[model samples]
Target chain A: MIKIETCLTPEILSLHQLEGKIAVVTDVLRATSCMVAGLNAGVNSVIPVIKVEEALEYQKKGFITAGERGGVKVEEFTIGNSPFEHMQEEYHGKDICMTTTNGTVAITEAKKTAKEVIIGALLNVGTVAEYLKEQNQDIVIICAGWKGNPSLEDTLFAGALIHRLQDQAELTDDASFMALAQYQQANGKVADVIQNYASHAKRLSGLKAKSDLSFCAQEDYCSILPILNGEAITIKKN
Target chain B: MIKIETCLTPEILSLHQLEGKIAVVTDVLRATSCMVAGLNAGVNSVIPVIKVEEALEYQKKGFITAGERGGVKVEEFTIGNSPFEHMQEEYHGKDICMTTTNGTVAITEAKKTAKEVIIGALLNVGTVAEYLKEQNQDIVIICAGWKGNPSLEDTLFAGALIHRLQDQAELTDDASFMALAQYQQANGKVADVIQNYASHAKRLSGLKAKSDLSFCAQEDYCSILPILNGEAITIKKN
Candidate 1:
């Protein structure tokens, strides 16, 4: 059976809970969504780092780097953490290095436990679902809630995943049933998710992250699987 | 206008946010629930402190002090954070000094920002609702999310308060919509909240808080509002 666990915050999750599962890392606001967009636009591989300084260090090595602080893309980086930035022809078959506040921390943390960590967002939910269905071990859909708390969007994404995976998986109460109901009630309205979820609204109201939000919400925009391979995220080679 | 904000976690809520709102301290798993239960059962007042040692110190004043560590009540103390414990007629109409892990920290934090702090949970939704709706300024509904990030239950409670006060106020992107979604989805499922939203769930589950879980789900179990007066949570005079 596919076993599922949900963590309200990233800080409290254990490697033991993640051990050997095909972990799916989601930070739907922009990080994971941006990564997927870049890959789909033809970037060769994306490297995710936890710190701004770390991503900056790679810039000299010819890696196009992206950095974010407090949701807005840092202006000094190779790109801001916007999915729109990734959807460019120049990015095709290129190497992109990224650093984000919450997404990268969660990705790094999940790497320590799971044998494999897969990135998911609405952009690639079906792909993740299909990928997990083929995998034999249990699956953990990790919601990288903002600042380690349950942000509305992250939980909604998890709820969406759970909704799809219900028949084939067992869910933990650590995942809120209410989250699933809300996402369902919205009828998977991508627009509503953008407007109603916490971080998305914050981004919209504060940062003019409309394109990023719209791009981030684009369901199944890419089927390219970005898997964690020791300290970085890379698209799986078929 | 009435307002409610979800703190989302027991940690990381800048105690600074408590600056000017009506703080509603909620810990449905037990803390605030037990405090409310204690009030209904006749405890004169609850002196909330951040540390257990402080709770112990109050015992010297000839007060019936209560303490809890993970979730269960402490030994030697007259009560753990439990509503059932609060039902004791012997404890009614007498002062009870109290300390618990997350809830107390939350109360202490909000005390700094709020004009007045009140205890809230699903158990006292309507009364809290009526109280908030009458307010004209921004009211902050603080949920002591487990250990400093948004928990499922707290956000839902915040959402319930927001839903109740929707017509009377506006919510920041940080909480209202996000929290509203979570509450709508969870719909007062106690088991789901503990398992999904709370960071300290496994520990609480280990402590057998499952029963506490059900008991805490009852809406407005008591109408006695535990209003924070100066440094104490006392029955709201209505």
Candidate 2:
């Protein structure tokens, strides 16, 4: 397996290395978690845009805008960058033009290398892993950190994914080995293990995100694989 | 004060975003630590170069070439990337052209933004911190990680430096907070804290770089400040 790894610090995620392979975009704190929740709640599609201007342009093309900055929803957008917002009745069958500080940027970057893209969060870690195993292809998981730097939390999620992919794929990258070793040392207690990630703790501290952390922390919360083909996120459902 | 905070992923050290500050290149591994030792042992100047070829070129220009790859001295270079190699009597008063995988790249990047460039490692952390504290200028600490990704060790060092300077400046970035928290949590217990840094440990195992780690981990080993001027590193004397 050709597994290459890159830490998705928010800025790096703004544009991922789309050189090759299937890209797994992971934003455990809010964005991908929100995407999972949105799809689970029956949203039709998520159109990711990096800039608010692009999101507005998507809205002009008859899409619904959903976003939050510093955890607050943009005034005109339909949703904040929260899974809590995704659990509502209004999103069913709606095309979501989603933008956030990190998640969307990561999606844009992942689109560069990924012929096939999958959204990864702790919420769907199991399904994502199982689906990747079924596909049996070279895969790259890009962790979208809070900003332009690698936050410990994103690396932890990358570690978790690497841990799951062990035995199924050959690891060649140093970061891959490090992630696997870290995940192994944690011994599957991902929640407590990830507490070392200060950004995760900080993002979850004072908002509805505190509870969302548990939601994201739950393993295999959904069996559905939300894959990105062309431009929209849809479930594998098979 | 302008406090630019960067993470220490081995990869990030090479992929730096340095702009407008005095750049402080940090490699908790062996490069900066070795550079500090070399300067302490009375080496007149240390030239930081990215490519081995550049070091060779510098050697042709009447400079001593000192460098290593994967812990062993490169076949063509005169020195290994070790603090001990740097302390050799032959290096005293000699201008040394040095290169390494990650730290040198970061120093190069920081050069673009910093008015002054300095090297910091665990061995010189206290001295660097004290110098920054006294200089009263906006400072940036670029952690040269093992490769290009964040390492717990380097971030811990960044946090340590930030903690020392936290009273002097407001951390205006998430990178600052992340480093601060990491440093606060992992202070003093360096070995246990960085045990999850499997890649680094494995590289050290291959290189038998234990002494380098031990010396790098030493507190206050060097009193001199290795500053980057033009293209070479020079001692900012007491």
TM-scores of the models, in the order given: 0.85, 0.75
Q: Write candidate 1's Cα lDDT for A6-25 as tens digits.
A: 66557657523677778788
- Segments in model 1 whose C-alpha atoms lie over 4 Å from true places: A8-22, A51-53, A69-76, A112-114, A136-140, A144-150, A176-178, A196-199, A205-211, B50-53, B145-152, B186-215
The top-ranked prediction according to TM-score is 1
Error of 1 at A21 (Å): 4.3
Q: Candidate 2: where is the Cα deviation over 4 Å?
A: A1-6, A10-22, A49-62, A68-80, A126-139, A151-156, A159-223, B1-4, B9-20, B50-61, B68-76, B151-153, B159-172, B176-220, B229-232
Chain B TM, per prediction: 0.88, 0.89
CA error at residue B229 for candidate 2, angstroms: 4.6
Candidate 2 local lDDT, B1-238, one digit each (tens): 6455565553443344455566777877778888899988989989899899999999888988877776668898888887888899988999999888878888887787667888887777777888887888776677776645565567667777787777777654445665665555554766555543435755676344776666676666667888888988888878
> Ten-residue segment with the worst summed lDDT in candidate 1 chain B?
B199-208
